[model samples]
Target: MSLATTKTSKIDRLAELTAKKETSSGASLWREAFRRLRGSKMAIIGAIVIAAFVVVAIVGPWLAPYAPTAQTWRGEVFANQGRFVGARGENLFGLDHLGRDMFSRMLVGARQTLLVGVVSMLIGLVLGALVGVVSGAAATLGGRAGQRLDDVVMRVTDIMLALPSLLLAVSVAAVLGQSLTTVMIAVGVVQIPIFARLLRGSMLAQGGKDYVLAARSLGIRKRRIVLTQIMPNSLSPVIVQATLSLATAIIEAAALSYLGLGNPDPAVPEWGVMLSQAQRFFDNAPMMSMYPAVAIIVTALGFTLLGEAMREALDPKLRG
Candidate 1:
């Protein structure tokens, strides 16, 4: 065989091997993360619990046998009025003070709880990301101006962080008055500092990396580099933090509601409101509090577990 032909054959063979290697090791980051998540039993359990809550939130009212607000009298009381009864055939979870079905109220409350959690999370994520991205990008300005901008933004975040999250949320809720919207806004505002600080730190760390420097050397637009390259790379931690923050938002909303700072209308069913009302009947019907409290604990646990598992999966240092 000619020397040139032999060299061409060797080149073709090397190309084939490279293609095979690429095919064998070409999984995307998300796909790898998912594979790691699937290997985690806690993650699977958390996912199942979260899915159940989502299903309950979506179809709970339809699944309930009784109207959340309808009253059913049992024993006769003063002036021929019948007193409320506990659990019965028609009412699986039993009756509240006014003879309202506990199970039905709980079902409706699930929808409210999930709605507040999701909406508040979205609000926090959007506002926080914007603040963090802007603050981080400002560092590119360099010199005294950059330092001043960073100091100003970070001081504002520090001021917010100085207060306890719950206290801040309570203050906002009080100002907004008692309503679901108030609870959501309060919780969302509380979350802003946390996400902003986390994302700002992430972006700052990424800004000093080789890839960012390379992009700068290529003369990429400052905005484009920040948005497209730096932001996307820094989002893994933010996404994990978001999942954890969702659980916190849910708990905070419930707390505000329990304080009578949420949905003033007594007829409205919400986990926190239900817990507040259940206080009156605690002696006779402790299950009222039990149900709502258990629901809150389980939901929070699910989110916590899921967030931890995601962190483990996504972090290279944690991967086995």
Candidate 2:
């Protein structure tokens, strides 16, 4: 065979192999994400713990051995007969001052904690994404106007970032008054800057991609292109950000609760309020502190692990 023909055949084979390799790599990416996630021992453990807590929260009432509100007071001092309640065995978590079951309260508290985290992130995402998309798109109102808006938004974000988050939540919760809804709003409002910053950066980065430029060249509506094309492309980063934000939101809610700005009813078994109330009794009833503290730490750790896994999976640079 001619040398030129041989060379052409080699080039064709190389191109074919390259195409197959790329296809195989792309297919393996999803599988690799699951493998990496499962391989992270801490993340897997965290996921199990979080899942267990969620299940407890969901079925707590049914599993509770006694009504959470039932009080068993005895006539004699230090000899209370119907006083002890719930899962027996010397009261593993013990009873609160009001005689409510600690375990039950913790189970119920899960709903509150999860609610605040999810609701806050949702509100923050919507508001932040709107602000970011408009400001980051260079076509809208010329580059100077966009830059000015970005500057103003970023400065506001900086001011918010400067303030201590826990203190901010406490003050807001105090002003708003303690309630589940109020807690959600306080946490959500505080997180707006985070989402805005994330979205702005993502949008700006995505806007410069070839597909985005092609859309622009094709005279696609800026709004449609941004919403339909750019937004979808940026979701991987945003999803990871959201997962991490969930952990932050949970901690913030706990902080607010610790300051007595959480659930109005003291009977509710929330970890933060439990910690606040139990700190004084730490020397006497350490169980109170142990359970709730562990819950918060474990839950937060779970979300953090999930976030890390997601980041590694989606980011080609980080993936091995």
Candidate 3:
């Protein structure tokens, strides 16, 4: 063939390859996962719930009709006789034992509740991810010495995991004493082992993949290979774990608060604290407890649903 004809044929082949790549089902892992996530009913519902919750957390305090700590209708509530005022024209959610407006308290408390969950989860994620990276790096790239280091780290995480999560949180709270910081630290500590173990295992799996071997063969630096290749591939599980951890962190934080280890200020309304105090008059004022309990459940469920949806989307096995 003539030289000009051969050059034209090569250009046509290149165009064909580019077209095939463009028409592939997934553009990239994250984009494809997001596409799948958008189609999931559970994800849609969870996203809506979480969005509403975040809005409330951000503005609920400002929008509250009355001061959350105010006993505006003290005389109206007769908790001893189970005669607290039901939902009235003024107090939409009725009055608590102390005649505080349930609606107002619920609104103001949302910020604190979300703060505890997000901050505690971040605590676990940062510290746990740090440990996992160190351990996984040593095991994959450090030769025999690295393997031993990994063994020790894994053993420590195993010990932490052996204990019941709630019991560990309670123990931490007791040692730290009663405070909002104590509750966040306690709940966050419980998640460390879980996130650490998950990330480490994911890295180990990814370390043996074909791309890692190819990177090694290409004379890529160890640090570069781990950071650019293995680390990114290993993050899917960690991301999913972070989502799931948010749900558990909220529940555990609430449990600590209910146990009287959460924020020392009684005037501040925390959902868990509200639930704890409402039990005193639960027989008559079920609405007080119901309000917080339902809020907690719905919030946790939203995170759980979103986490589950993410796990499915990120799983290569689930890909078509």
Assess each prediction's global lDDT (C-alpha) against the native.
0.78, 0.67, 0.82
Tens digits of per-residue lDDT, candidate 2, 101-146, equal: 6776677777667777889888777786676566556433237776
Model 1 stretches astray by more than 4 angstroms: 1-27, 74-84, 140-143
The candidate with the higher lDDT, 1 or 2, is 1
lDDT of candidate 1 over 1-320, digit per residue (tens) = 65434533442332222111011257655677789899999899889989999999999999987788776542322223433355778778777777778899999899999999999998888998888787777875355787688779877877777777789999999898878899999999987866776677777767777878998899988889888888887776678778888899889988998888988898888898899888876876688888898999899889989988887776654444
lDDT ranking from best to worst? Answer: 3, 1, 2
Displacement of the residue 289 alpha carbon in candidate 3, Å: 0.6
State the displacement of the C-alpha of residue 140, model 3, in Å, after optimal TM-score superposition: 1.0
User: Residue 215, candidate 3: how far off, in angstroms?
Assistant: 3.2
- Model 2 residue 242 CA deviation in Å: 1.3
Error of 1 at 75 (Å): 6.9
The window of 10 residues in a row where model 2 has the poorest summed lDDT is 14-23
Ranking by TM-score: 3, 1, 2
C-alpha TM-score for every candidate: 0.87, 0.82, 0.89
TM-score of candidate 3 relative to the true fold = 0.89
